[model samples]
Target: MPNLPKKVRSKKLSSRVDLTAMVSVSFLLIIFFMVVGELSKGKAMALSLPEKYENGWHHWGCGSGSNERTITVLLDENNKIITYTGFLFNPRKAPKEINYGQNGIRKELFNQKKAILEYSTALGKPKNGPIVIIKPSKKSNFKNLVDILDEMAIINIETYAIVNEFTTEESQLLASK
Candidate 1:
């Protein structure tokens, strides 16, 4: 009877998988990477601070002749900009309030720069633009500082500084205005 080979059947196997755990792990990893990236992001502005020397501060406007060619810009709260020329104790004129636009700080810078150039030429010295000193108060925000820096580039200013501290007179001037 052919070794009695009859009515033999094979067992079938199911082909199904559960992907819920894998999907959950993938979502958790995505969220973790996103949070880490956000935490690593930085918001800071680049400022070139002047070097210190043993014999007082060695920087622009150190000589007596260049004193008259300095322009100081004070950035207070509420987008207020106060500009003046020469020393804080003896300003060339009262600190004037100006805005930020084509008819504001830009125009003031151009006019002051022209005046300084003319003065330098008149004194038989090489024509040089004014040395701008930007002083941002603690209450001032970053946007105003950036705007002033942009103005510097747009006006083609050759020399400038970002001073962090303010003199007593400068503080008083800001308070008065």
Candidate 2:
């Protein structure tokens, strides 16, 4: 027998890869991000401050010369609330002491608002609703400020300002109290 070639053999290789752990890990990461995103949402109250005009006056009242159109609220220690209508130098009316409650500041604010609207209507002029000026004394606490602000929100006050300085008459009133 002549020399003959033996049967040739070919080797086969596996093409499959084990990716079960990778798929599971990717799904877990997606779920973690979704939960974290949902948990990060928060609620906050918005505060809008009055802007200063070119005439060196605040948009709320600082120097608008409209005493009858402004109401000042002074927050003092012991949760005292003192309110005055108009300018400190020549107040349109005497300051009144009020407390923090629905029947206290809230009632007074509503009454004042109604009076202003009625007066403006009688004069046949555009509605000049009163603006609230909130001043917190040094002894007043943060809770007092928050309480007054809440009162403002409840009454639907469209314009208001929080001033830090105290006028001479305001100091006198506080001293008298």
Candidate 3:
């Protein structure tokens, strides 16, 4: 009888995986993303346009009212802003280019507002601030419009309009610069 040789055998390991931790981690990640999405929100600004008259003219002026209390701002290309007080044909203050920011249009607005209030008081009329008329030409970009609107808001300007129409003289004025 021959003695049989003993064969070496390896032990079998378990194939089952623990999915509990993975499921918990995935839920935590989902909740974290949801919270972040809710926290981040977009901000916006509000704009109110004036009504048009049957005569193809817009009801203008604000605060104290009257045409002489109006400040016309013409936005042009190359970041140019031409400002004049009262009517274009016969202006109380002639048109001139002004910059943006605190020193430029902002400063002018403050001065104009103060002057209009004083003028109204002296005339024994309603003492109100100036009415700003904003005319942005086709050459101007959207950013210019937005920046000007922001400036108006920052200046606490209550009455302003975005007029699209431009006269021949306005175009010529824009071209002259």
Candidate 4:
């Protein structure tokens, strides 16, 4: 045997993992949370009952109710004005025709105003009434929402509301319970 020197041992080095995948996942999660947060902004408000008058008649005047007359405006999925009902001339009468075509929203709004005037005259009350009640679907478009608001302002409907829809089943359950 040749010269057998002292044996030397080499220490093994630990391997390092690349954190690229982890970084990517974290970024994706951040983006998802941000989007969700944005989507839920300004949707936490509560709904209150529309106001009723001293005589038990409710009028949504500028979002207040005082037992008078009211107009209910329903916005559909497309954000287009879908239905305008309640008090064409009196609170008891059915609403007039509602045409929701591309150019018909304004036309219908004018008609609503006319109907309001007629109703006020018939009832021997002041022509000025409370705000219109706007029931917009949750998924309504922002543009449509703005347009409706503008139209309400133009028509001098100072009071209004943005209400959520109610399912028939939900109503029935509540009624039963």
Candidate 5:
């Protein structure tokens, strides 16, 4: 019988998975999400606050029937805006819901501003712009507030304020319409 040489067996080598690509991809995803979250953040609006006090807080003008130089806008749901020249108790212009746009609130503001300027001129007083009071209701969204602020800016109104507190009458008024 011929002698046969036995074949030598080679040792098995273990295969390792490289996680470099996965790690890189994960880092990139994290960074992308972080950037997206930052971008999705709400942008803030700039506000200019008045001094401590003013001489014409409630009193708009000196002459009678000429004090309709101010208007209060109550923002409600679905872009509903309730506007009045004075308080709901004794409104100079009355409480009525107006639309939102150049033809709606903008035109009203323009006419009111024009009337105020004319009144001041007739009274031989300075042409101070009309005042606007913005009251955002509970049901009103941020967009509505922003739109009103934009209108105020578009009208070039100098005196305007965002009031958080709402009176009972205002609440009822907003609920009615």
Candidate 6:
């Protein structure tokens, strides 16, 4: 070959990559994460707690009967509601006794109202359709129990029942007669 520079002959080779596909993939991932983050922030649990019945069986005046909207509030060992089940009337038979506590009672009651409101809105009706029922554990503190009742009164959820898990059978039998 003629006088060609050795340096020129030793030039390094390089390859080019198209970034369009990578950019598109990154954008899609970002959108997916954003949507997932928003959805995850939604309420994870929804429930309306019921009121306790001293006599074990109480009547809900609204012709709801078995079809009535039901809400179950669970009081843990500390007398606080661990969780709640709403929109279900006539929960499984009651237990012997229930306990109620005060700390989270207000929050639980508010949660019930919120659930009822949402449910009513979804059904294109008002919040008054649903009846709230409360069940406290037997070991619950009296003060807390009364406080929950007072809160319900404040909200005007008058149609309610206090049921013990074990007494449900007896109450049903009495109603049949």
The lDDT for every candidate, in the order shown, is: 0.83, 0.80, 0.80, 0.57, 0.78, 0.52
**Tens-place lDDT digits, model 3, residues 66-177:** 6677888899888899998876776789999999888999999889888887887788875466778888989899998998999888888777778887777778888997
Compute each candidate's TM-score over C-alphas.
0.65, 0.65, 0.64, 0.47, 0.63, 0.40
Q: How well is each residue in 10-89 modelled by candidate 2, as lDDT tens digits? A: 76767888899999999999999999999898866666554554432243545443577678899999999899887666
Task: Provide the lowest-lDDT 10-residue window in model 6.
Answer: 87-96
- Worst 10-residue lDDT window for candidate 2 reads 52-61
The most accurate candidate by lDDT is 1
Candidate 6 per-residue lDDT over residues 62-100, each given as its tens digit: 343323245554443454443333322344323223334
Model 4: lowest-lDDT 10 consecutive positions: 168-177
Greater TM-score among 1 and 3 belongs to 1
lDDT for each residue of candidate 1 in 1-177, tens digit (9 for 90 to 100): 568768868776667788999999999999999999999999786554444554322336366546678888999999999998876556775689999899999999999888888888888876566888899999899999999999999999978988877777778878988
Please identify model 5 stretches exceeding 4 Å from their true place: 1-66
Evaluated against the true structure, the overall lDDT of model 2 is 0.80
- How many residue pairs in model 4 have overlapping backbones? 13
**TM accuracy, model 1:** 0.65
lDDT of 4 at 19: 96
Q: Considering only N, C-alpha and C atoms within 3 Å, which residue pairs clash in candidate 5?
A: none
| Two-way lDDT contest, 1 vs 4, winner | 1
Score residue 99 of candidate 6 by CA lDDT: 33
RMSD after CA superposition, every candidate: 7.2, 6.4, 5.9, 10.7, 7.8, 15.3
The residue-level lDDT of candidate 2 at 28 comes to 100
**Runs of candidate 2 exceeding 4 Å displacement:** 1-65
